[model samples]
Target: MEFRQVSDLNFNISRVTLGTWAIGGWMWGGSDDQLAVGTVIEALEKGITTIDTAPVYGFGKSEKLVGQALQEFGNRDEIQLATKFGLEWDDEGNVQRNSTRERILKEVDDSLRRLQTDYIDIYQVHWPDLDTDFSETAETLQELLDSGKIRAIGVSNFSPEQMDEFQQTAPIHVCQPPYNLFERGIEKDVIPYCKENGITLLTYGALCRGLLSGKMSKDRTFNKGDMRRDADPKFQGETFDKHLEAVEKLKEYADKNFDKKVIHLAVRWILDKGIDSAIWGARKPEQVTFDNAFGWKFSHKQVKGVEEIVETIVEDPVSPAFMAPPE
Candidate 1:
């Protein structure tokens, strides 16, 4: 695995960070606790030093599993651990957005206990809390930083305006947003702002929820509990068809130019865009191996080919009006 220096934070992060959402067992179709723990160990053995998770993921189950895995390894300092807070899960399985000082403090303590670590390397706000003042959250995070509970601070799923608001109060070291060949909405604002402000872009949804992998068939139907089946726009009827058309073109390019699978080509295309790191949602250790080997370098021609192909079919990100509730 390759590593990149997030200049602002001065941490050397793996170019491909392991995402623990799938293992969280709340959104993904299949999850295995043993597999999740083994995958983290496997990733560490392969030199992957970054692991991203959230408190809401499995309602703290994910953090507990991660903690167990790290304890087994007995080398926590060798890795950079990142986890998030902000979203609250209710009894009805609904997520309530809250970033108030009291909520954040409670959540961080709970995460620390579950993670089995004294200080998190990177602590991120899962998403913006419009109902609360940004300063309130920022100040709370600053207190955590001052108290030595966290080394760096970040925000996930934040719009450009929200990012600016948080930055005005605190120095943000990283920003996690969904960016892929199919989702280029960040190009309009978020990406540029991060580049200009020296903030690292740690992108998720690099595979468009597995669409770019070319594994989903037109007849494929997700299980009832799978989150993507219900929420991801790219998996829906007409949108899925359009995305598949684009993936077919990408496959053609991959075959002719790289002699590699389309998934590798897809991941490499995003890496070539100057993203600091790509967080992959892997459920099994084998998936981590596949993603780790999915070529990080691309030739100039291959890069240009991806740009041309993506520009042909990519559309603006789904408007806020179309967004589904967060899982």
Candidate 2:
């Protein structure tokens, strides 16, 4: 129910954005179209009007489903649509980072058509394409900004140096990065950099691929398409058990201190760190509930306790870099 402004945009987006990566049904096994559409409506009705998706998500299925949901909702002016470009796919479903001017130009129209919107609230580059010039991509996005097709520009998985180069040609109103209890790499630099520059941070993977959802069991199995089955090392060997133990202790900590669950604790921790928003991913409508994460504050001592829980248990923690596609 909380909202935050991106500073550059004219409107405010919900503090919790609905992430449709799973709904796209490309990586996290397949999803039900009916369930996917219902998820969007469920989020909106729950006060989550900011929906974040990408073209490479199901190669466009996510956006199309979002478009269908928007039409069903019947109020385009009230919702903030955040999507991305700079990624292309093949018939076999391989994706490559391609921020070339031509790629973005063509992709923007496709995104508009799929989302059934004339202008995107926040348009971001999915990944940094080292083959392309930062200015080239920046100028192209600036052109879209000038044309009223995109209200704000953002970059994801970008280092501070990459962002420095990107801002030379255009302003970055937002920055999307992988951040959560398990992935704290951004805290070393990205968080501080965005804070100093007045850029809004919309962090993704808040649940760390369902690891922190407090619903995973030791014998749980993943589908062939699930990234956790192979791409993520945290899901393999002792590392998985270490994280699961940490999640268990976190659950206990949440219930003891706040009468909440580990998932709420995970979200409130991110928001308390001053991040503008956290991208909560879910393909099912009932999975979108997060009211417990709000209306409470984490004390410094409580935060230290959660940190101790993670640090003490997950000695061999892994980064989320394994999920990144080949550039």
Candidate 3:
């Protein structure tokens, strides 16, 4: 339940943000609306105030569910709402990036309607559209800010170069990227650039899409719709086995240093890396319980130890090459 300022924006958010992609059920498996609603309620009760969602997720189904859950809880002002646009989901369930000025304007209106909110606390471009001019997208974001439809605008899955290009035209308050013990790509440039520019680093995949949990076995199989089953490189064949081996080592460190679970150690490790917030994509209440066990305090030695273990196992310098294209 520890809180931190989301950059210098004068607003405080919980260290753990509730990620709504699981609730979207677009690429993940076994998502129940009631279960997702219960998880959201439980997260708010447990002091998690920030909820992250995207319009492309389930082609707006996720935002609708989030709106219903918020209305059911009746605590809109108590929570910090964040969602993204720019990724379009066509009739065939294909995802495409569209950051054109016209598309951005229409998407913001659509998102606000689905979210049941007039203004979003944090509105981000889900990915960079290289085909469109960065300045064009920035201008549209500025218009949204001026119109009060969005309080702040940020970018997600953007490289250091893209961030700089967009920031030159508009103010950015946050940066959301995949950053975890298994994915330290942000350490190269994105994180340092955010620090230098006073942008908050809101990290997702803090569990490496559940790789660091030490639960999935080598023979584990995912449902056909489970996107990571086919999309994640680490989840395929020998890479999956190697990933589990690394998690075993992390478990040893967790056992020796503290009584927390491996997942808690994983989360604490990310927070210790100077990240502004860690987004948790917990579908069940039990998952939340595991994440809540570790809070704001970790010894410097322990932090260093976790880093060393990850580096030793992965043996790859964190790089932006793993980032998916805007689509």
* Candidates sorted by TM-score, best first: 2, 3, 1
- Tens digits of per-residue lDDT for model 2, 116-231: 99999899999999999999999999999999999999999999999999999999999999998988999999999999998999999999999989999889899988888958
Backbone clashes in model 2, listed as residue pairs: none
Clashing pairs in 3: none
Judged by whole-model lDDT over C-alpha atoms, candidate 2 comes out at 0.92
Taken over the whole model, the C-alpha lDDT of each candidate is 0.82, 0.92, 0.82
Best by lDDT: 2
Runs of candidate 3 exceeding 4 Å displacement: 290-296, 316-327
Q: TM-score: which candidate is best?
A: 2
The window of 10 residues in a row where model 1 has the poorest summed lDDT is 316-325
Query: Over all chains combined, what TM-score does candidate 2 have?
Result: 0.99
lDDT of 3 by residue, 153-233 (tens): 889998888988998899889899988887786788988999998998888887777887768788889988886685777
| lDDT, residue 192, model 1 | 93
Total clashing residue pairs per candidate?
Answer: 0, 0, 0
TM-score of each: 0.92, 0.99, 0.94
**Which TM-score value belongs to model 3?**
0.94
